[model samples]
Target: MKWRVESSNMKQLAAVLVCLLAACLADKPQPCTSPPLLTGAFTVSTQNEELWQYAQFIYDALGQKIRMKDLGTYDNQSFTHDVLLLFREGVMYEINDLNRTCKKLPLKADFHPLAIPKDAVLLGQVVIGSSSGPGQGLLVNTWTGDIGGTYMMTVTEFGCIPVTTVQHTNKFGWIMTSFFNNIIGITDPSKLNPPDFCPDAMTEDVTREPADFWSLFFNK
Candidate 1:
């Protein structure tokens, strides 16, 4: 059966759950955890830099998390897919080297998040200190709803931490290339690969297949 959430108690639930989970990190909680790429809260330096530079960065941060790697760029030149990060509770973050720091974004898997209005919510009022225009980007309170379509959200983060039910769908979908806005929250299942990541971060039961992913940057 598909998961559903209540529109009202979304934020409270998320906060309470996050707290409970954090208190019990020593005990361990289970969700989905097997990804082909690195699935953690990370900052994608998408400043139009080459994939080779990111390769070196990852190698410095995570020596063996990525055993095998194959990154595709735009037009066989310039870097297009800057970074692919995964998070827990169906959430993830990424930033392209194109827009420097303005492109920092987060990817969340809940539907309610899309329905949140910037002026309506209180918790979301935390000043982001962004350099871009004012009153931009989307932040919806996800968790309560009948998910019939595919969704991807990107939230900027200073560190990598797993959240309840969020993961980075970096190299698992065409959203990386065929994107409308910055986030990939809505799409067809046929076009997305399962939530997968790397660094061998697994919680058992959660598995992945590379065949599930599609490379829009490719013509195949």
Candidate 2:
């Protein structure tokens, strides 16, 4: 009887230790850097029903470029495609693989589609970690324009890489939702290389006069 009681107490202590270890691991912060390759599915929900949206991304941090494929369904039809965007040496290029073309456009400072809009407000820090890993999270201000509701977004991270984002708005259903999975480091160097062909410059305003150009230059 004494031996059995001692063994039972030992088991309980072991279980307690395991729980503590897990709690500690869960609280650890993920890295702020992004993974090289991340593939994932997004979903849009309305009337309690959900539809799958597609997104696959490859990041070339060293080259400051990104390649992505985005697919979504509209009007009961589906569409799919890929696009490569390069930002190098104060220039931006939009590459079209199927047409074998590239478009050089003016580089708007700090312009990124996924970046938090300049008008949005920044909220306090947050933690969205789950069982799989820590999701050091960011809470920010947002809005549901169509429904005229209050919106909030939580950008979740995994070791510096943003792996998931959860958005919510009062009076608005699940309008947008996205998360990442199958993240892997990039191994192929070719994915970072720029296209060999030269791209044409974006069309300029035809109405601008020579004097206007001089004025712009002098102002800069």
lDDT by residue for model 1 (1-220), tens: 1234464467679899999988888433222112222222222222233222122112111211111123444434644343332323332223333344212223322222112123221222122344366565432222211123233332222111112222233432212221112222222321122223322232332222222222212223
Candidate 2: residue pairs that collide: 30-159, 31-159, 31-160, 32-159, 32-160, 33-160, 33-161
- Judged by whole-model lDDT over C-alpha atoms, candidate 2 comes out at 0.48
Q: Put down candidate 2 lDDT per residue, 87-190, tens digits, no spaces.
A: 56534454567777765545433323343333445454444533455545443222222213444444444334343444443323454555556455665556
Model 2 lDDT-worst window of ten: 210-219
The number of the candidate with the highest TM-score is 2
What would the TM-score be for candidate 1 when compared with the true structure? 0.19
Task: Estimate candidate 2's RMSD in Å.
Answer: 12.4
Each model's TM-score? 0.19, 0.44
Deviation in Å, model 2, residue 66 alpha carbon: 1.4
Q: Per-model C-alpha lDDT, please?
A: 0.28, 0.48
